[model samples]
Target: MINKRLTFCHENWSLREPFRISRGVKTCADVIHVAINCDQVTGQGESVPYARYGETTESVLDQIEEVLPEVEGGTNPEELLELLPAGAARNAVDCALWDLMARWQGRSVPELFGLEVQRELETAITIGLDTPEKMAKKARMNRRAPLLKVKLDQENILDRVRAVRIQAPESRIILDPNESWNMDILRLVDEELAGLGIDLLEQPLPAGQDDGLREYRPKVPVCADESCHTSQDLPALTGKYQYINIKLDKTGGLTEAVRLRELALGQGFGLMVGCMVATSLSMAPAILLCSGADFIDLDGPWWMAKDREDGFNIQNGIIRNISGNLWGGTEKAEAAVS
Candidate 1:
């Protein structure tokens, strides 16, 4: 076994403004950054401990520590999947290993997977949940963005969506209720949302309770977020969702995320790559999964008050560039913790 070193720490990146979703609001992004060193080469990754998944920083830290010995003994991404479940802990380590391998091979992660990295890709700009007037204002501010992801809940569903639709009539819109709506609400709003030109509806119903979607057809395409994680969950999501939102954190990292994407597409599911509110270190690895995705919602770093040097360049909802020194590149990884 190759001698290696593993280290991790918790980081809190303050958001420029509070990001509100159906569940709650977040003013800071709490994440865990992991690094693995071998033969004087370092690779790094980051993950957000999602409260919606019952993950806390402490819990994630403990999970990583428990696997420290095996990781330092030179475990690969495939082996790390068996060591940790699909969540934030495995995500960090898995991504770090991928970055390490890519560096060792003198290629970018996308190249390692036989994929070409786009110089610029259009991404969705998120407008967090708020009052109709406030939401409209936010939409107006980002009207130039190619795509706008509007956060909504059960309350004022029509009002909120209508407000955003009126502000940015030309921008492609995605309504994400974040598992806050019931079948009745979805049925009631489906036609109206379709008429309003809402492009996609994400996870209207909660996980384990969305079996009702099997019989209900909607005017708008539905994407599964909370309801789907790895490829194992794809079987259950087959008839219910038209698209699956693949987030590395939810899939345990790019390793499973790639498998999930391939399997989901084979099963006739469209793709949407997403991310929790996090730093560029987290979003950098996700870029590999965005090649043929139908919807890209990787604006996590756009919400940060400040980002790391040599991070992704996002302007007007388009990711223009990803520096080589970032997470999954051929260049050496820098210290990612703040």
Candidate 2:
């Protein structure tokens, strides 16, 4: 087998345009491509930004560059956990290795990971920053998407939710305030979200503010996004959140992500798999984590104006090519031996 070297270039995909949220957004998301080659076949992975962790595209690139020697020297994903902290750079390299190992052995990643199957996962299409009316319009346009995640800032929470609910009355909604709300708003808006048929609310308050949520309850279940990263972040979140948003970038890569999901499920925390704006290569390995996830939010690549050559497909909001079945520009399905 040809031991493939890790060589990559930065890709900047412009959002068809910038979609603002209360926090902020840009016209583009900087992505990194990580590939593993074994002479006979090559496998790839991708990753994106996580500003919450003070990570920019430049920072992520720098992290990978720091680990250049190890990755080239044939660092396995297990050893990678020590070389790099959990973030976009590590996520790409780690996932690339898993993909490479699977392809080299002539097995699907899930199969090699000892996973039963890569089932159909329903994903949530995000409605980025717009006035309440415009967001409502966006929701209306996504008629085929089974679920819609309504992005909220601290301001005008109810108006935006009301608008979106009005446009797609039959659809299920999830509200993500990106850690902008507090105990007060959470209580005030609880009734409104329930009336609008919102399924859940995610990270309404800043991570530190979660202490305030202790002993307090809201009408809808609150999920921890920024507050919960790995299993280590779970202990403090016990009484506050009923759900946890698992992201490989946050946990470093799929290696720890799977463990975190199992731990979260055992702790009675519902699961949601979310993503930053990345390519299909970035989302491919994450499909494995969605097996028991209650909500799927892998819509990062779909927002890009142009994606990588072998990215997954999002049909009517359902992730059609998530398991790498539709990759490499071929329509053939990869089946496991009976």
Candidate 3:
């Protein structure tokens, strides 16, 4: 048996600016970095603890600690799903195990799963919630971006989206209400949002309260974010959402995320791969699922004040390349993290 060791710690990276969503504002991304060492090789993964899912830095660390012995004792990602429910803790460990296995076999994670990596992926540049004029200003700045994800809330929904649509007329726009809107408000702005050329509407209604969606069909395609976590949640989401946003943090890790993608596709649900405001380490694993994704929102690293060295190169909403030294690649060892 190979001797495996596990080490993890909490890290906080400051954002370039306040990232506001329907829930609240975040100036720093609190993440947990997990490293597994075996046979003189090391694998690493990162996860963000989101309070919206009842997760905090302390809770995530404690959860990882609970499984430390099992993880070091050769617990694989498949067994990990039975150990922990889908969440941030499992996400960190599952991804690390995948990295470790890939390194052990002298292959990249995508190769291990028989996936061909895309040289370039067009991602969505996110514009956080702010005043209408401010949002428009941000949109204008990123007008050249291929896709723009605009955050909104119940207040001034039409004004904010319209402002962004006008500023970035050529950009494909996705409106993310983040579960802040109800059916009444959705009906109120559905026509105007479509007229503004909005491409997608994400999680407009709060989870468990989205039954109204089954009866009301909007002009724009709707996606489920907060409403869907794992494959178990997919059945109920049918007829309620046109697309499902897959985030590793929500699915526990790439292991389950890949399964969720296949299952969602089989069920006729469109796929959107997204990420929390984290470093490239967290985004790297999720990149494996972007091959057939309808929308890619892995622009988390772009919001950071500084990212890891050899991180993803993202410009104008396009991810040019993911360095080999980054997570899940076979070309080099794990990138140094400070």
RMSD of each: 3.3, 2.3, 3.0
Clashes of 1: 0
lDDT of 2 by residue, 49-156 (tens): 677788887888888888877777778888999998878888888887877777776667676666644545678999996898889889889967888898888788
Best by lDDT: 3
**lDDT score for residue 170 of model 2:** 76
Candidate 3 to truth, TM = 0.97
The 10 consecutive residues of candidate 1 with the worst lDDT sum are 329-338
Q: List, residue by residue over 1-338, the lDDT tens digit for candidate 1.
A: 26689999999999999999988999999999999988877889999998889999999999999999999987888899899999999999999998888777766777667665566788999999999999999999999998999999999999999999899989999999999999999999999999999999999999999999999888999999999899999889988899999999999998999899888888899999999999889998887788779899999999999987777788889996675687776443221210
Instruction: Rank candidates by lDDT, best first.
Output: 3, 1, 2
Better-scoring candidate (lDDT), 1 or 3 = 3
The 10-residue segment of model 3 with minimum total lDDT is 329-338
State each model's CA lDDT, in order.
Answer: 0.89, 0.79, 0.91
lDDT tens digits, residue span 1-338, model 3: 28999999999899999999988999998999999999888889999998999999999999999999999999999999999989999999999999888888776788777766676789999999999999999999999999999999989988898899889999999999899998989999998889989999999999999999998888999999999999999999988899999999999999999999999999999999999999999999988899789899999999989998878888999996675567785664322210
- TM-scores for every candidate against the unseen true structure: 0.96, 0.93, 0.97
- At residue 85, candidate 1 shows an lDDT of 99
Cα deviation of 236 in candidate 1 (Å)? Answer: 0.6
Off by over 4 Å in 2: 323-334
Cα error, residue 186 of model 2, in Å, equals 1.4
Which candidate would rank higher by TM-score, 1 or 2?
1
